[model samples]
Target: MTDTVLASWRDGTAKTAILDFVTRATRQGPDFVPAGDRIATFDNDGTLWVEQPLPPQFDFVFRHWAEEVKADPSLAGRQPYKALIEKDPSFLHGVATQDPQVIESLLKAFARSWAGSTPAEFDAQVREWLATVKQPKLGVLYQDLVYQPMLELFDLLKANGFRVFVCSGGGRDFMRVFAEETWGINKENIIGSAAEYTYTDGGMVRGEQLLGTLDLGPGKPEHIFARTGRLPVFAGGNADVDIEMLSAARFALLINHDDAEREFAYTAAAEASLAKAGELGWTVVSMKDDWSTLYRNREQ
Candidate 1:
């Protein structure tokens, strides 16, 4: 199993550090983590998979909103929802400061548009989109663009007795869809931004009911606490939004995307986050300098 897993690494620090961490964490024996405490949390989007063009959940919500506005033209004139439909990134930029009412309204609108759909149905939709959706610049299927080293790291951690959970800003439902299809991760262990839903006599009804809070920035740590009840010993992510959650872990890693030739070469955000994380004593993994294989695909 080690040899088989090492074959995927191709001599990268991502693999090396992951293997070392797993061995060290597990070697402390069953006493340290125990059976139920072997928890490892990961950020989705930029951490586990490619979030370049746009986050998958964002695309889904946007597409859904576009269809709804197309059907009811009046919705196109609304404030937040209207801005979302118009592709105004600024609408969601400083979302932390937006009125709770505004956030609630937008979330409900999104839920109503996407609710009543079964989990299986939602999964199918995402899979279908991934099959056809191509990144604007890469021109490759979005699913094909996931980070290879990160995937290997996930497997390595799992093999060493860590129960991996995706603690992301993406919708929990959408993360479940991709996790099941791509990595075979259990749906129950996935935690992310979620809206309210109800199973009534009629059917499953999704409402604008805000479940808890958006899982990003400082909210990442909040979600981790709410969902896991205990701090994760190991955590991995790639952005400033993940710093809070990463800081909560005993072993924290930031996937620094600095290699433009193989993958993307943008690190301003990552570097800023790493500086803060360094102050907090977190390990920074440079994709360019540390990972020999940045992406799963070799040809593209």
Candidate 2:
């Protein structure tokens, strides 16, 4: 009976939309969703954390690749290694957003760098990266860069029996590392792009080949259905890659990074997603207006 579910959210259309959805989704409500079907999917990177310059996973890949390039100069000429060698901000920005060529190269680099390690080994590598790396402008650890308001939303959805999942364009194993610690979601609920693995010798070993779909853009829905076996009823995202996933949901939430001062702002990367949200009557959450705080550590 208290208006405290999404307390971090300002009283606006964005906040109001979430309240109404949860209320209608309760057991007594006419439009209540079954407990089993109360599925909520979230995108990581720009949606859950800071991804302005580039996704944090890309930073990890670059750092590892840089070390590799140092050991072997020959790897520098490759498609993805070249991008890492240049370390161009523009290229990084392009990869972060929607430059298909740059995105392809980045994905390739990621697939190549992460290959040959077992799941346990891969997780240890990500944990090491998280401990060492910090966001450029935020200057905080990557795990600390998560959005405060979205975290509240996750809690609200969980309290209301919504099964939350992090369906990201980022690596599945990479996200599973922090999904439980950072987002309080089960690692089994995380779904993302994957590297192929084979049962060779004894255990499942990761391969250099990228398997399954890219899990970006149209690939989001494909991967989600493949993993969860159902279309999401509630979906949240920050960029165009999430458009397909959001479109498949009954209640779509789009996080628009319009807060230039508190957080970085960019609409170009998600223009088409924004347009689709408008057409689909999705809730467009304005970071500048809807959220009182930028991140978990800093509250307004």
Candidate 3:
């Protein structure tokens, strides 16, 4: 592990709490961690990076779809995806939640559109795209905008025998791309919402040949169970979609982005779920109040 000092945005209280958790957890020395029980899960989108306005992966796919529409012109009149390209905020918030079929259709289209490439090839594409892409609001590379405090926390926990995992609602393949390239974490340890794919002689295949339901919300816990068998000891997230997964953990933390100056201040369906966590004894960390820094500018 690296000798990195973890800082907190709050008045040192959150930092104290975290260090206490780490100390007590490792009090039994180097071999103290519970066998196969040193699991810590994190939500990727809002918790780890900027997700407001749109998720980075969605923005990437939408950019591709938008370019296609520009070529066809007629594609501007199509449903859902068209609305998405036009930057219809309501279309994403409402349709994605209220209309199940719409979400399924969009995801299927994304899978089909990006399929036919080997996992390695697709990962390379994502890495190249992230290197060149900049966030509209932050004026920084998407990868540069990762939360610094959280990154430090990841290292701190790892030093204390915890195996950190990103259990996100974003595309598993997309997250894996960034995780492997930027953090040096193994792809197999990172789990997220996914569309099914089939193995072919040449490479993995998608579309009709692929069969499975997309993972989301409650399905997160199910996927974790199927993959790891052991429940997580610690979990952190910033959305209602993560409630079930958080609830399944022994120690859960919620990152509330309340800093309007540093980051957008907005609320979502995740609030009620967070309230439930409060009642259930989960720790809630306010971004504005708990984090001293917003991002560790990769350019720096």
Candidate 4:
């Protein structure tokens, strides 16, 4: 109920529901959840940051593919590389909608591109990308586009008894590179589609294979349980791929991006999630109405 926490959230049902849930979960009552069992998970893309124009990880990968195509023009004949050369939107549209088939193709190429590279090398490249690249439309770093309200929610949850984790369909190690600094959570708390590794030359190198299922739809809950050993008691997401993770939670928060003035507004991929939220009575926070502020700097 205090403005110090969730300050970006305007006084409304969405904020009230969050606070009330925390109160009930933390208090010694019938609804009280034990500290160890109070796990919260969130989807990273549209839920935590601006995901419109496609997710940021794709931007990073697309740049690499473009360079590869330039070096070997024949590579442009392939599907994904061809997609890049022709400026095709089908593959990217599928990716934006969390199409598993498209993502598998993307990740397989991702693995092949950087196979045998050390984790340190991959991490350094990701760090440099984050540091140097500015989001095209917003004209600011991707890290700066993260929702201020969500960060405040993280602080509130941690202050209570909850341990939070980010579960996404993006590359696991990629998100882990900046998870701690950007989200203020441990790098180990990021769960997503991951590349396997092989120990060679006295160091671990990325293997040319995706480690497990693509982390989307049902895969979201699967990865969360695989890592944390339990389903989330609290969850938040903005897209359809997050359905299973949100469904597994006792408290589900869905973000509705209905503000075009401050942020893009459309539900091309999230239509089902929006319908499901209404059918299930899930809390849907409107970016237009629910947030007093969108970004930390408030200049964009």
Candidate 5:
């Protein structure tokens, strides 16, 4: 293994854990996992990118919601729309985060926005948003704010014969739009919350409908099992919602967001999971201690 494998990662417990995992999981090691069984799953939001202040997808939803209220004056009386109109930060924050009802409402909005459209149409909407939208806090495109060290980890793991899968609580279709370009993982490998789609015009057009699964908490492992037919050898997540998924893996990682200057300082969302990591001997990657850099400039 060369130094460049994880150059962006600081020399610490997090980096050592990764190096040791790769070494032990490689062919020469006595504990080597078979290539076929070398499966790794990762949570998307806070684990892969900046989910502070708000989850990135919420930015997309907020805009869509605004347009909805504008087109229909009565929508202004609704809970989400009223909160948005009143600029209630706490209310917006809940909608942007792990709140179950808010998550469901956002999914309904997503369905309404994309239903009766082709896959191409949905992708185009996400593409346009990625191109046009910027994070309110950082003033950078959300796609461009992906953690650089994690991207390096992906390349390293793949080179070592590990098949990676993203098992995220974020909208499946929403993550699929940027997963390939950002993570270098194929869309089929992504396991996220999804809505049912109805075929139309001989399958050329599809309409999004009711959610198939929410993909949070215990649903993480359930969805992963239902989709992959195997439990992952490795898993990474950042919040309590991922506790079940992390617990189900042979090697688990909890990405602790504690870098106040470079990024966010957040442990409240994953406090229970953090305790679990300690009790179960799962590795917790510290954003402040493990990463030397949060993100890098993307090539246009």
Candidate 6:
């Protein structure tokens, strides 16, 4: 049954555990979860797609910032711009590790970049970026890099009456642009750090202030509960920032990017999460061993 359900997943303990959990959750037993409360949330970066080099959202924002620097040379003196100008690996490393101070700095600038733009305007900008920019190493559009195995898992969960949400620390508006087309999830189901909005001049416009929180660490479950009214029964993530969310779930699956041959492998950001997985007895999915394929074909 697991073989037919999770086609891109190899036979392994991770697969078996997932199948067992789902079966128990669906069956009428002590561990069974009610359908309405069957919620699964996953961290976007690393867990659902490639996040190396930089997260795709940062790549999008950085492109715009580069052009911003070109337009006004004075802005180049500031951080993010300064970091980009000098090609600072430490700044990039901070982002990869989801260092809070680093992310907060970026978000402040991000909010300023499109302060008063309407949703349609923001969406158009994202669409343009998606159409033009390709992942650095893969040479394919970023949207095409979503994992096929994760998508199959989504299908299996949905078939068994689970509501899945993609929760990320990246911009919610950015992900919503391609959520339906790329992840096959409704825009509302894509939860992330978001800017507040104001209704003015007969339209909704973005505000410089972030909505509530930056959606990292504790913010993940906070945002999930705020939006869904409950914590996830199942959750998946692959970095230190995800530990809180993973720990909150009944079944947690952590992805280990140990497949340098098919996909880039490094434990730079995932060390703590891996340790937590071991300590908590959370199921660990090895990219090299558990997944038969790394990505969906570009044509897909």
Order of models, best TM-score first: 4, 6, 2, 5, 3, 1
Better of 4 and 5 by lDDT: 4
Q: How does each model score on lDDT?
A: 0.71, 0.84, 0.73, 0.91, 0.83, 0.91
Candidate 4 C-alpha error for residue 25, in Å: 0.3
Error of 2 at 288 (Å): 1.2
Model 4 TM-score relative to the real fold: 0.97
Instruction: Report the C-alpha lDDT of model 1 over 234-298, residue by residue, as the tens digit.
Output: 89888877878888887888877676776566654466677876787667777666665656765
- Write down the RMSD of candidate 3 (Cα, Å): 3.3
Candidate 1: segments with Cα more than 4 A from true spot: 1-16, 29-32, 84-89, 92-108, 268-272, 297-300
**Mind giving the per-residue lDDT tens digits that candidate 6 earns over 1-300?**
635799989888999999999999999999999999999999998888899878888998999999999999999898889998998999988987778789988998999999989999999999999899999987888877889889999998999999999999988888889888877899999999999999999999999998998899999999999999999999999998999999999999999999887768899878899899989999999999998887887432
Clashes of 1: 1
Instruction: Tell me which of candidates 5 and 6 scores higher on TM-score.
Output: 6
- Stretches of candidate 3 above 4 Å error? 1-4, 8-11, 28-33, 71-74, 85-89, 95-103, 207-211, 298-300
The C-alpha local distance difference test score for the whole of candidate 5 amounts to 0.83
Per-residue lDDT tens digits for candidate 4, residues 27-62, read: 999999999999999999999999878789998998
Over 1-300, each residue of candidate 5 has an lDDT whose tens digit, in order, gives: 888989889898888988898889886767789988888999998989999788888788778788888899999988667887998877766654587667777677677666677788778978899999988777888888899988888898899999999998788888999888889999999998777776665774545565576888888899888988888888999998899999998889899888887777877668799899989999888888888877857531
Error of 6 at 108 (Å): 1.4
lDDT of 2 by residue, 12-94 (tens): 99898888888888857678888888999999988999887778888888788889989999988986778657876777678
Q: What does candidate 3's lDDT look like per residue over 1-300, in tens digits?
A: 122458534555566666766676677775355846888888887888888767788778777787777788887787655787676877788533323354556666777667665777777778887989898987878998788888888878887788888886567888887786555578898887565677788667544322345455776787787778877877888777788888988778788778888887866757776688669977777788787787885422
TM-score of each prediction: 0.85, 0.94, 0.87, 0.97, 0.93, 0.97
Root mean square deviation (Cα) for candidate 1 = 3.5
